[model samples]
Target: MGALALVSAVGLAVDDRILVGVPIWAKPFKFSVSFVAYSLSLAWMLSLLPRGRRAGWWAGTVIAVASAVEMALITLQVVRGTQSHFNRATPFDDTVFQIMGGTVVVLWLGALVVSLLLLRARILDRAMAWTVRLSSLIALAGAAVGFLMVRPTPEQLATDDSPIVGAHGVGVPDGGPSMPVTGWATTGGDLRVAHFFGMHALQLLPLVLLVLAALAARSVRHPRFPLLARLADERVRLRLALTASAVYAAVFVLLTWQALRGQALSAPDGATLAGAGAIVLLGAAATTLSLRTPLP
Candidate 1:
């Protein structure tokens, strides 16, 4: 899947035509990178699960095929010199869009099944298990953000000539002023911020625990490291992962809230700041309690 995406990206880049406001190749290029990332992350996560390897493989296969179908449709639309998403400009385009949407739903359902399997099984390391479970849930939450983009905002319905419902930017129409490269909104709310953060939680949460585990291992030999260096026990590491996961989930929710309110990522008001502070305080309290409590 990753290889196919890479090939498609290279092909698109060489084409070098502009579509809508950006390069025609940009959509495939971005999707390729995302597909590679998601594929690698899912593969690594499934490898960590105990038992159900066959089931995991089936689920992973479904996800890969569905994602490839989505990428293929997007690339096909790009080649046709038309919009891939929220585009019902013609009957054929509408059919393609529906197919892509259905593929995404299949991918999401496959992920949910794998997550359920991971949650029910016992892995070798408690910390790693918690990380897998938490990351799966977070990633799923991130995928849910796509629905916001799929459904048209009230502004879009009132403004767009077509019956198609789609808009990426909140409080402003899509394709307005956007951030460089990512093209996320710079003047209004962009749900992609939360979506991006949420999608990578699978990689990020495990990475945090892996780093902490490495540090703790090193401290055992050196003995002069910081307080967290002493957290060599599986239970201690699990607690830490849980605490960090809680904080991470809170930030994801906060970003979604901020975007829904039509506030740009760069322009948070005092109230937003206050809300962030509260989330931090609550996370800190939870972490402290986790550290103090004894495991059964």
Candidate 2:
């Protein structure tokens, strides 16, 4: 995956070709880097398993294979200077898209298996164990979010010869104005925003635990801020983990809701702000309660 990322980066620099309003190599470059992070995280999570290590490892292998296939097909499309996703311009193009979709399904199933194993296995830390389990399940849901694009949009349905069957954009075309680097639509709802955030819960939730532990360790010798020590407590960490996951899950839902309503992320309406404010307020309340909970 690392090598693929490097190659795609080189392609991005060397190739001036544009497809779907972005640099042709952009998708491959981003997907490769994402796969590198995902593969490494899953491998480490598998190592944390006590009894279900074998099952987790098997699932990890399946995910690795599926990721490789997906990346390969995406890179092939990049080389051909065509869109990899939702492209049904020709029979060959449709077949490529179908195969890519199949790989995604395989990848989701593999993650699901690992998630179930994590639910059954005990890890070194209580917080991280549950974080892994919950994040994995959420990540699976995030992966499923990609399926939303598979359904043909109204415009595509109206057009008799639409080359694409679906799109990432809700009210606008996929190749329209987008944010820098991320390529998210700037004028309309982009489902990729929700999908990206949701799929990364596995990385983000564990990061919350690490940050908490690091802060505790850094303040171990401090006379002030004695509450930092609570982060070292297993019970405290577990409660905080749950709190963070709840807020994270809520935010994911909010983004999905915003996109489905054809709202641009940067221009969220009153409803969007209300949903976000609710998430923040609730998260703050949950955090305070977690801190007040007795730790033994």
Candidate 3:
């Protein structure tokens, strides 16, 4: 996957063919980079299993293979100088789309299995155990946000013989004004915003915990008091984890809702801002409350 990312980078630099308002290699490049991170995170999570090691290993392997194949197909389409997603101009293109769709499903189901296994496996740090388990589940919800793009848009529906079925942009065409490198819609609601945000929880949540742990490592040496020890407290850590995950889930839902309503992430209306403010207010309140309330 890393090699693919490097190759895609070269393609991005040299290949000038533009598709979907971006370089032909841009999609595959992004996909390759994402798969590298995603595959590594899942592989690490699977390694934590004291149980289901074999099953988890095989599942991870299958996921890696599926992701690789999906990336390969995207690259192949780039070589053919055509779009990959939502492109049904030809029969082979449609088949490739279907195959990539199946790969996504496979990856999601494999993660589901690994998450279930993690819930049953024993990890030394109770907080980290929960973080790994719940993050995977949260990522599951995030990955699901992509389904919103698979359905035919109203324009597509209006035309019975439309070659393109759906689009990532809600109120605008896919190739319109987009964020610089991400290619996410800037002019209209984009489902990929939530989808990308949600999918990254698998890595980000664990990273947050690690950062907290690092802060906790320099515990106070005072005889009677330990200032940093609370950062490492199992109960405190668990409370923070649960609170953070809840907030993450809420934000994911809010993003999904905002996109569904044809709202851009960069330019939110009053309603969108209110929803976001509510999430921020609630998250802060919940974090404070979690610290105050004792965990059972």
Candidate 4:
């Protein structure tokens, strides 16, 4: 699953049409590698669920189906050498992307939520319970941020030309607003920045939570170390710190580069920066809190 996702992401990056008029050959390659790494990590996680839980299996299936659709759509774009990014071709295309994306997110959210609920029900071990709860928190936060970023609105589909009619040459020019900034209280570029950071939160939040879960599990198995022992567990702390910090730093740098390169920074740019900063701080806080709280 990771390998496939990586391939799709890379296909997305390299495609010139996705970048709103700018074309870069190497961009796709970069996306390809990055996406592969991220997807593999996610795949590794989905593989860890117990086989006995019917709900978990179903959730995994849903996620798999959604992911497959996403990959196929993106792959088609890459293979056809067409620009399907953001549904540039047709409204349905973009809608499909959103639906698939949302489905994947929702399924994962459901799984995480269910896991936590089960843990609370005492159907899971201490370490497992803590892991699911923390994971659900992160997943919920990510979903909230993502919904904000891609919330369906008039602005997102605002178009000067009727996408359907224009293709057949039966529509007026300058039909309506194209990608309006009204959905969010900021400029287009700023919103873009906010969206970028928010969407990626899907990755960072889970990574931290899962890593913490792994550490706490190890501590629980050790007879000498108890609750505080888990808290003082340097291995987990170091891993969490390094993973979160590295990912955040890299994303921050890339976002800055993208913004600067596009020269899209304006008054709202400050707002974008603030949004991204908030996300970073939120992730950091969540990780810190989870680590600080000893396993029960």
Candidate 5:
């Protein structure tokens, strides 16, 4: 599951066109990898259920079906062209993808709600249950925001003011003049912010919990006074703290590099770096002060 999620994460973060003659509307390999990963992950989660009716198979089946439908909708959209604007007369294939992709999300939400109810009533104590539930809830919140931002009105593709938001492609020439076909990409939807927050919750939430777990382990490994006689035992907490700090540092640096590539670094990036530096320094100081015994 971790490996699959990691592959999906890479795909979601980077866009690569591996297939030729693919429509621009189609998602690149990155998106496809993430989609496939999510599908497989969901199936694995279902596999964890005990044999027989110990778990609510009905609810699980519904959730699984919804998940599959969601994937299929996305797949269809990538393979088949979808019309951006409904007001404009569109071909049959175009509207089909729109309905499938949009409506399947609603079904997914319904399935999620049912699954959550089942979890709270009968499965909350299970290992990793809370993490799955919290992650799904966070994702659902982001999905809600995205759905609300969508335009219900039919779109006007010909007009400069599009009824549909987030449409990007080539623009036609105005008046009777003929000009070369130029691509014009629009980014007003604020979709990226929501997606960035939502998709990453899987990583962010787990990392948060891992940090907390590390802190707990630190306290257990070293009480008020260190075990001077047993150097290995004495330094366990410090080791755990350092390990966690290193992982945090590496992920932050990767993020910084990404921000640089996009030229999106600014005061916020600087502030984050400063905050991370403070954390590492404080952790180091605490570890050092707790272990200063002249190597007894």
Candidate 6:
């Protein structure tokens, strides 16, 4: 599935087409690559659970189908030279939009179920268990952000000619002064920033833990290693993972808050700066304390 998505992304990237002031192919291209990465990460994490292979297969199947459907609809729209999301321009378009929305909801629910399963299971590695639980929850929160995009803001309803459902940008309309490749809003609040960060937690948390595990393994075999091995103990690593997850969650919340308040990512004011600084300091302190404390 990942390979297929990658191929689709490459194909779309090479295609010469434009729609609504941006490359129409770029939407599916980006989504394809994201889906590939997401699917691979999810599969790897699910592998950690006992008797999870079957469960993973079921969950992965559902997600893959839903994601493929979504990409197909978006790509179809691109081929037709029309908008895929929040477009109720016509009855047919509205139906397609509804299908896409429904498919995404299913995908989100499937993910939630997998997360619950992981949480309920009694895994041996405490740090990995916690990492899976926290990352899944964070990813779900990110998925929930899509709801905000689905519900039309008052500004969108008043301004757009079509029956507006939702938008990506806040303060300014969508498609205004976006960042380079990702096209996230630079001059206005873009919910995608939060969504992107939140969804990738699954990959980030586990990857960090894996690196710690590797370092710990290396230190055990090689006593001359400079870094203290005590910090690499399972308990300390668990504490560190928990602290990191908390910090990750804080950042997600801050981004969501900033977007809701119509603040641009690149143009955070004094309050935003102060709030972000405080969070960073707290994260640093927690990490330092976790590293210093001796395991009982």
Best by TM-score: 2
Q: RMSD per prediction, one decimal?
A: 2.2, 1.3, 1.7, 9.5, 10.6, 2.0
lDDT per residue as tens, model 6, 1-296: 45545655675668667665577777877787788778888887677778666876788789889998998898788879888999888999999999999999999988987888788878898988999899999999998998888767777667757565678887767778878788888888889889989999988988988888988888888878746585568899899899989999999999998988888888898888988999999999998888888567
Worst 10 residues of 5 by lDDT: 170-179
Model 6: how far residue 234 lies from native, Å: 0.4
Q: Count the backbone clashes (under 3 Å) in each candidate.
A: 0, 0, 0, 6, 0, 1
Ranking by lDDT: 2, 3, 1, 6, 4, 5
Model 1, range 88-155, lDDT digits (tens) per residue?
Answer: 87889999999999998999999998899899879888888888899999999999898888887786
Q: Taking the tens digit of each residue's C-alpha lDDT, what string does model 2 give over 1-296?
A: 89988998999899999888899989988988888777877787888888877777788989999999999999998888899999999999999999999999999999999988889986878888889888888888888999998989999999998999999999999999999999999999999999999998988988998998887786677737768866767788899999999999999999999999998899999999999999999999989878788556
Number of the top candidate by lDDT? Answer: 2
lDDT of 5 by residue, 80-171 (tens): 44333222234454565466556557545654654465346444322245544555555455444435333332244345654244221112
- For model 4 the TM-score comes to 0.48
Writing each residue's lDDT as its tens digit, candidate 3 over 1-296 gives 88988888999888888898988888878888888788889989988999899999888988888888888888888888888888787899999999989998998888888889998989999889999988999888888888779899988999978888889999888999999999988889999989998889999999988876776665544324344567657787777887788788888888998888888889989988898898899889887776666677
TM-score of each: 0.91, 0.97, 0.95, 0.48, 0.46, 0.93
lDDT, candidates in the order shown: 0.84, 0.89, 0.86, 0.46, 0.42, 0.84
Query: What are the runs in model 3 whose C-alpha is more than 4 Å off?
Result: 221-227
Off by over 4 Å in 5: 1-30, 36-60, 73-77, 80-89, 101-103, 118-133, 152-189, 222-296
Ranked by TM-score, top first = 2, 3, 6, 1, 4, 5
* Per-residue lDDT value at 78 in model 4: 51
- Cα lDDT, model 5, residue 219: 56
Model 1 clash number: 0
